[model samples]
Target: MGINTLAFLLFFVFGITVFYLLPQRLKWPFLLLLSLSYISFKDIRGIVFIVLSSLSVFLGGRLFEKRNEPKDASFRKKILILTMIFNLGVLFFVKYVKPIYGAFSGKTPPELDKIPFFDSIIIPLGISYYTLQILSYLLDVYWGRQKAETNYGKLLLFTCYFPQMIQGPISRYGALSAEFFKEHRFKLHNLKFGLQLMLWGFFKKMVIADKVGPYVQRIFFSHKEPYGLTVVLGLIFYGIQLYCDFSGGIDVIRGVSECFDVKLAENFRQPYFSRSLGEFWRRWHITLGSWMKDYVFYPLSLSRPMAKFKKSLKKKVSRVTVNRIQIAICDIVVFLLVGYWHGAESIYWAWGLYNGIILAISALLTDVYAGWRKKLGVDPKRKLWDNLFIARTLVIVTVGWIFDCSKTALGSLNLLKNAFIISKTSFEPIVLNLVDWVEIAELIIFCAILFKVSRMKERGVVVREKIEALPFAVQVIIWVGMIQLVACFGRSSGEVGFMYANF
Candidate 1:
């Protein structure tokens, strides 16, 4: 029941109608039952995820409470760490190892090795998401940033909130716990906003992302030696494909949550408009980046070795071990983990390392280059040059996506070589005349609309508010038009799932 599917639409409409009609006190339990039913409908194995996640949070909170009673913070920390490891371990095993083993060995594990009666472990939908959310909750308790939820049902609801159960902006316990217990009320404004956002998401996913998919798939799956220019174009298409797919999914999740009168975190902000890799990350998958920063990077930076390094550098060797260097190393390590978090594949690993290397080099040269420019009285902030630099950075980042999408290191290298290294005579054109013109036109129109929407968002312009203020008939017409476009162009086959679902 992916958010993009017709089944999800029906389920969501039914859930919303029942939720608003039910007594306030019964809403949580009703939703809980719905969640369970939804899970059962999708796959019985999802129940395992719900139970495991709920138990982990329930026990983790209890353990934290116990440690607090004894006043042994170290013991609590150890428990939290161990709990995280176990959760992640389970996640890793179910998501990666078993599949790889089955792929290679062509034999199932013995019954004794299996997970209870489930002949094979089915990594439930949003396991990675919920697991991370649960771990973050435990860690928050350990850090004293949030109190442990003693109520099992409330904690469970936090983990399995149906609106965010599948794809999430990864809500924190502190942020969502109160909302779970509070009485939800239906709001016309929220409903309107949510539906509008969902419509836009469907547009991005079904219209834009799916449209680009065929070109990308055709080139990548062809297994022919496509020319370098075509390969470059394919990589650019993939970058757009990923952005539209993942962010579009987030939009749908957010919109659905809004209909429940719950506000989920925004996952993306016009990331393509970012001027640097660091800035891009801040905008892209914002929830995950925020989690990694708060839970991983900050703690690691404040750890003994990094702290001592900062101290020693402040007193001596000022040029060698700067703050950026420290941050770059940490960024590299975090991104390496981020890369592998997608899957246990060499290509993914290399993709992570590639970004790490790029960021590290960028950091290392930043201060030196800035200083040199200042000494020469060159304004590094000049708009023209800044725009050029940003353009170059975008190209660099797009090239990085080639490695991310490629199946092997050699394949990535060959694509890059053909795209940039080979002479003109050796080039092989992949896009025939009419298709090329259509793609180019589509790309232009998409970019123009994207630019306008991005600017509007940046400016805090509420197009929806204006729409709502318009005559009801006008709004209905617009809605009808949106639906017509969706009906005509949306990916009806359901084979094109969200890109982030794989992660």
Candidate 2:
């Protein structure tokens, strides 16, 4: 069920309440049951796939652990390879088979109905999310870093943990397993803070994201073909919508889990505050970037071939230049995969390369830019310099979103070209033409609130903690007002489900 829906809210309330009342021994079991129930409710047809994937990882982990001997090294390697193939292959075919097939074939592939067991299901719910989670578990086990759960059901519970299944922070096994199996007691502080966080999340998603999303999408793709500032305005609105929708959903998920004293990995920092594309990625979707770094980038960067290349480069270039060259190569590969993982579309691929290339350029030019800045008497640490970089980074990131917001690479090019061109629509009240002034005003007010909140967070302010410190009656009044804001202005962020859920 969509987390933004009232029905899911009721479900969460009922589940958490019953969870607290359950016996200590029964807590995890009840949670497993609820998680499975959620899967069953979402797509009964997906039961077979989820079971097979989780069970394979669980058994693979057991087999790997048992065969931990020098003599069994070859066997262990084979097991890991086969298990990864099976898990990833299923994920790929289940999720991308149609688009990928059509991409090459130039025609619609045979209907999925012809495929066994996949007839009724397209992409299985959480298939994209849980696949990475389980793979991380399998890899950790293979590397002898973490122990596999002896009980298959417990491992299954970890994979199907309901709160994070919708759109994940892509948590690691060691980090989340403790939170899952820990002895959790109900605390009034958890309840208060959790609810407070959820309220803020609702404010972001309903008050701003949902309100801005439709209008942005309409203007962006409208036949009137918006240009210049109209395009710029749409891009900003889209950026806001994307962040608030994804992060707001994550906040709700985290808040609910926190109610159970289960701490999920955080998915976002103040990403927009980042002054570099590298920093933006590190800050945005914090878990996904970390996952790629740990699983993809580091491994590739340290591979024997890379080691050889790095050694070869040292003979011809400075140590820093050698590292930059290695970084450029590995980053290009990582970001390409990152893009393809987002979609099979050329636009996504281009966006991925744009980030990878820009980051690489920034790295390669680090010394050059610093030298120029020094010569120009521009202190790199100056506030003006930092703000200038921030602005530049924002523009770069927003340009990448044009690719994301478009249907094709060519479409992205058109949008980018028009995004900069002067036209009659450039200074017009184009957004007001799209929606009423009341909505425009509401968006302004909410966005200003969002900016203030984000600024405070960037400075490490705990806004929720501040709210918690308020008098009980004052807190009640605040909650009531928050609820009223959502009630009156909410566009139901989940009316169409979260944007990231598609990925």
Candidate 3:
């Protein structure tokens, strides 16, 4: 079931209740059973996939731990390769096949009713996320960074923890495994903080993200030629909508884990405040970006071929330029893979390329930009310069969102062309027509609230702590008001699924 629904709430409630009541030793098994039961609602095959994948990784980890001698290094590498191929093969087969099949046949992928004996034949829940986790764990074991878990049950729980199975912050074995097995006594503070975070998530997803859905749909999904301003506005709305939806979901998941005294990693960090495309990625989807940096980017940069390429470039250019070129190549490759990670779509490729090019240019122009700023009497540390760069970065990011929102790469290119076409009609008429004046005002106010909170966070205000310190009645009022806001605004949106779930 979707994490936002009442059913999942009830499931979480029951699981947590039974969890703390049990003896310390039984906690892991109890949670394991609960996770299995929760996922089984999708279908039986999902359980099989989780079981087999877990087993494969478990075996791989064991092999690394057991055979990790200096002499058996090549065999350990073989084990790593085989494990990666098998798990990633499953993910590619289930997740990527449908897009390819659809392209050739011009029909939707066959569903459970059309196919036999495999109702859950679709990509098993969290395959994209958990596969990376498992891969990370296997790599760690092979590299001697961490020891593999001998306990299959603990490893299983680590792999399929229910809350993270939704949309993950992608927990690491070194960071999360100890937390998983630790005994947590029940605490009122934990419950209070967890519920508060979860409520905040509800407000973000239901009130803000879903509220702007129709405006975005109007432009992005329209059959008629879209207005230029309207398309740009739609892309802007989509960027906000996606951030709230994905980050909101992570908040809910983290909050749920918190109730059990488990701390999941934070996924976001005020990304809109970033002044560069590179900084924006570091803040937005922090876990995924960090994952690629650690597991993919660093290794690829330091690989033999890259080292050889660096040697060749060093002979042709200065050392500084060679380093910049090498880094740009790695950054571009990482972003291309990141884009493809979204889906097997050309539009996503364009989006990845767009970001990669911007980042590479930013790297290459560092000295030139610094000289220009110096010559122009621009202080890099001044607020005006920072604000200007932040706005510029937002505009660049929004343009990339056009590709993300479009159905195809060509459609995005057309939208970009149209955005600059400058039609005679003023944007005022289009804006007014999209919603009532009251809603238009409310939208501005809602965005203001979001911006104020995020800006405070950017300044390190510790908002939740401040709220906790307020008088009891004021705290209650705040909670009640937030719930009322969600109840009023959230109901009309019906069921709004998260945008990133497809990825």
Measured by TM-score, the strongest candidate is 3
TM-scores for candidates 1 onward, in order: 0.90, 0.95, 0.96
Better of 2 and 3 by lDDT: 2
Against the true structure, candidate 3 reaches a TM-score of 0.96
Clashing pairs in 1: 228-418, 228-419
Better of 2 and 3 by TM-score: 3
Worst 10 residues of 3 by lDDT: 111-120
lDDT for each candidate structure: 0.78, 0.85, 0.83
- Model 3 spans with C-alpha error above 4 angstroms: 104-120, 425-433
Ranking by lDDT: 2, 3, 1
lDDT tens digits, residues 366-385, model 3? Answer: 89988998898987599998
Give lDDT tens digits, candidate 1, residues 177-286: 76666778888998989989888888788877888887788777665666656777788889888888888878888888788877788899888767778888899999
| Candidates ranked, most accurate by TM-score first | 3, 2, 1
- Looking at candidate 2, what is the lDDT of residue 141? 93
lDDT of model 1 at residue 9?
87
Higher-lDDT candidate among 1 and 2? 2
